[model samples]
Target chain A: MADPAGAPCVEVVDLHKRFGALEVLRGVSFAVDRGSVVSIIGASGSGKSTLLRCINYLEQPTSGEVRIDGEPIGIERRADGSERRRSMREIGRFRRDLGMVFQQFNLWPHLTVLGNVVEAPIRVRGLPRRQAMELARACLERVQLSEKSSEYPARLSGGQQQRVAIARALAMQPKVMLFDEATSSLDPELTGEVLEVMRGLAVDGTTMIVVTHEMGFAREVSDRVIFLHGGLIEEEGPPAQVFGTPRSERCRQFLAKLLH
Target chain B: MGNWERLVWNQRNVLLDGFLVTLEICAIAFAVAVAAGLGLALLRLYVRPLRWPAIMWIEYCRATPIYVQLMWVNYVWPEILGWPTTFYTAGWVALALQSSGYLAETFRTGIENIGRGQREAAYAVGMSPLLTFRRIILPQVLVTIAPSIVTQFTVIVKSSTLVSVITVQDLMFQSQRLVNVWFEPIEILTATAAIYILFIFAVSAAGKALADRLRLRYGLGT
Candidate 1:
């Protein structure tokens, strides 16, 4: 379903976002090539989550562009130099191509694990109930939660619930998966299990953009790392280079504060 | 004891018939209240253009006393709207109007109490707003507000007695008729009061059980 053969899986150019008087993202730009993993690392309030959200149009950008597989989303520009915000129907269709995982898990508590995974595929994708259930089972198997598919989210442990959330996203078969601090809300011990599933996805060459506080996972698993500072990219490069010898003093200090 | 047997027991068939009418009116009123309440609450919360009108209607229904509304609907509405042209129709309409307002507020509170994250999660998966509300939002709201909904129904049952003023021939109407016939208010009215207390007690108890069962089955209950 990925039609653009050479176009980047996800791209953002000169993105800016403001919440009232607070500017959360300022002129952020980057691209993730197909089948590559890029991790975004930043301090709290540095706009890492906001940047990820804008990429999927969850947080609308005040200005600039986000394109998925070379097609612009959220806002469309016309020849007359005016912008039209895309209709909810249009945006909703575009969002089907991207999967997003939240820090809160956000699983529908009323639904069993299988129900949560199959709901969108059946409702949004218009997949047959049988096909959706089959897809849901496969996704649950990938997360190693097939046994828990019949259970409600509240009955699951934190790690287990997050895994179900991942499976829920995976069922979409999205072109690029976005993780917005996906493991941040878990217990320290539980974070590892969720991170392990993410690492497996990276190994399987799923195109991904992860916003994280987990430095070890980011450094070891990511092909590239972008460190955000006050709504701007302070430094970005291969994880090895950014972590080993950062260019900016802020990057150096941030890494030092985290690593030690 | 003789009066109890004569006025209360001997008049069992009349009282029973009136009780059935009470049940019928309450059932119709409660059904309308649920459906209309949900519609009004959604309009108030989601439809920007209709929000103020929905709010005014809900407030009007709530602020007026039930008896006054009953009288107004029974007397004035026919002149103004030329509908609900019978005593029975007016009785249920007035009852439903009153409860619909309270239930609308209940539904709004339930919908608002849901976490924003739930809707965002549904949207993130590509579900449209309507789909999200139907499949995700409404189910959770129903479970969370089930107890309050049951309470509202009891309130409706209790308030249904006032319909007798319009000659609706409900339980209260029959008991009053018997009082006029025997010219004895003590025996029959006491029996009527006791019957109402017991009937309401049973309805609420059953409703509570059903709500609890729903919560245990679908909610995050342990």
Candidate 2:
């Protein structure tokens, strides 16, 4: 269901995160509509990854709200009508709505490609083994790695491993997909292979929030580009406006550095 | 010369019998140690409220000598607690308790050795903490620590000698009895040492073979 403002599938309100004495996210906020691609770009340590992590509740926000499908996640309204952090069990239920891909392609080393893809379905979702395997095979085909299903993750190349990771998330069929620098660990030549799978997902209207440093992909793929600096939204708009006009000094400087 | 050979050959059955009992104790104690060690490690790391209790148990068990622990469990615990425990029961239980602390340390190391990335990957797919531990974290940790665990088991077997002090009639106890009966300390004790060496070598080789098989199966690098 849509919120009063719009049918935003993902919403962040005044997110603030602190790691010990240091603050990582300072009053950050954004929204992503269903079936739209939004790329969040920033310099390292600007909290781009933390922002994506907060949305998926990977890193709990210090203060703020994350709403998925218009429902507040990882939080409960108290008797006095103030939000408090939910228990881990409660947060876990909400987490099922989103799928995330990571920089390291963290596929289970001992499990085969198909086994990695089907693990959550059988264990978390309690799907029968045959059904999970069938779904896993389909996901592998989507990522163009059906032939690699029996291979262990360690046996696959970096790009192939990342694709298997994507298929793993796809088998869950989540409403929102959060990518935390999914290609950052890969070599430049390998990054394109993973980006290609993501490009296909974007064309297919998957609701995605990508934290990336790839300027060309960010400019060409995202419906909107968000530029973050010092843990705040420096600028945000359609790719052309954000990329062309550059509203803020931080955005201009960040883009100038990224382009080169 | 013929009498020495006859005595050595005759004692083989007795040694084999003692070996079975020793093996049984090892198998049971190993199972108990793994379960308790895993629980203790989990308590120290995850169950924050029980951290002190887990730590205290691990430290207490690790600090005291195994032979002393065996005597306490066999001779003192029953009287103090007004409970009855056979020497055999006391033997394995004490062994399980003492080695469990060492095994717990290994488990803690294995658990911490896994990168946060594996945990996040499981969480990303909406896995509950329980599921993550069951499916992802524990399995990898077990594989990572298997060789260490096998080495620990070897230590456990060697320490099985201490069970003789509690009068459980394990291999060492049987060897001592044969030495007394035959009046041949050098002959029978030397044979006992040989037996231990043979058993330990078999165990280590089996452990290496298991590791090799797992390495191939998981495609783990050298």
Candidate 3:
């Protein structure tokens, strides 16, 4: 087993992001230990999604830095003050270790289910077509979707599509996975199916960072849970410490509303 | 009776010849327009330095009337440069450019309409922008933009009629010759209009069938 404390898998320091006049994230700082699950529980508009986006450099931070396994994810300014953004190719190479599953399940409609799973592996990683297809088949099997591999994304239910999205990401063989409210857009029965897959991943020690409103899932799956409110991390600890014992009035009030 | 037989014989061959010429011009010009339009759209989307220039070029071509553009390219560029290019080549070049402007905008819109999440999803999967665009974006764009492109192609076919002014003996030019000889203005003009309408109708039907097949195959409509 890898030592958990030696080196963090991801680190964000003093992260700040603003959209025009709207300040979304302010001085956010956190780090995720390897092989652990961290759940970010936040109300809507609390910058949780933006925080996930910032991790992979999908959304550029206004001012701050993120390091994924010690690899810088954002732009750097030179001595002459010329700002240099990473080329798309560089970003693609860096992003190979990081997979993000979206709430909307953003699966490519033009591709069949198997094609979606195999696309990145074959195109970006230059995997052999047969090898990529084999990997894709394995991922679909993991998601319990191998039978539906021939179907297109549109033919699947919301839950099934989200699972396919997860399989697509898994086909890349990522070291870390980010779930931005992966079940938020799903109906209850559909949400249950996706949560089951996530739970299975956690048991297998897949390092994951998830943003979700499913408190029950938070209680069940997370090793650590952080509540983000008003563009800042309000409280964080082990799930029991944060959920069982109340410390802040804000947390209490937030819990009360959620419980009701 | 022999006069009627001769009229039928003469008109069918003449119209067939005219149809072949019209198809030839449309095929060449449409290929040029699609290639140029896709190149311009990619430049605009990916190269920051070229974005404004690409937009300006598309706008300039789009804003100018096609007839004026044809006339200018047909008469002016060759005269100014002292090039010995043929009128047929000049006419096709002008039509290709004008059509490219519109097609570029169509491609750009198709690219942009793909949600930001789709790009983020692609990036998160470790696919490079080129791979993402080629495998993911361009395929979707084809499905999304095909209808508009076919519509524009139909328009391009009709617009090929403008080549008559540049000395290309296309359908409308043949119709004019027939009118001048027979002195039946309304009949010849109506016949030309009917032919064009039939071509447009056929193209639209083909486009619809293709779109439906794509939707069924890809499940995009769902």
Q: Which candidate is the best by DockQ?
A: 2
Between candidates 1 and 2, the DockQ winner: 2
Cα lDDT tens digits, model 1, A140-248, are: 9999999999988878999999899999999999999999998899989999999999999999999999999999999999999999999999999999999999998
In candidate 3, list every pair of residues with a backbone clash. Answer: none
Q: Write the per-residue lDDT of candidate 3 for residues A79-192, one digit (tens) a residue.
A: 897877777677778788888899999999888899999988998888999999999999999999999999988889999999999999899988789999999999987899
Q: iRMS values in order, in angstroms? A: 1.3, 1.3, 1.4
Runs in model 3 deviating more than 4 A are: A1-5, A75-85, B1-4, B43-52, B82-84, B181-192, B216-222
DockQ of 1: 0.71
Say which candidate scores most in lDDT: 1
Chain B TM-score (model 3 vs. true structure): 0.91
The residue pairs in collision within model 1 are none
For residue A203, give model 2's deviation from the true position in Å.
0.5
User: What's the C-alpha lDDT at position B101 in model 1?
Assistant: 99
Runs off by more than 4 Å, candidate 2:
A1-6, A77-84, B1-4, B219-222
In terms of lDDT, the poorest run of 10 residues in model 1 chain A is A1-10
Give residue A44's lDDT in candidate 2 (0 to 100): 97
Against the reference, the lDDT scores of all candidates come to 0.92, 0.88, 0.86
Task: Give a tens-digit lDDT track for model 2, residues B5-29.
Answer: 7666677999888888888898888
Q: Sorted on TM-score, highest at the top, how do the candidates line up?
A: 1, 2, 3
Residue A172 of model 1 has an lDDT of 90
After TM-score superposition, what is the CA distance of residue B48 in candidate 2 from its true location, in Å? Answer: 2.2
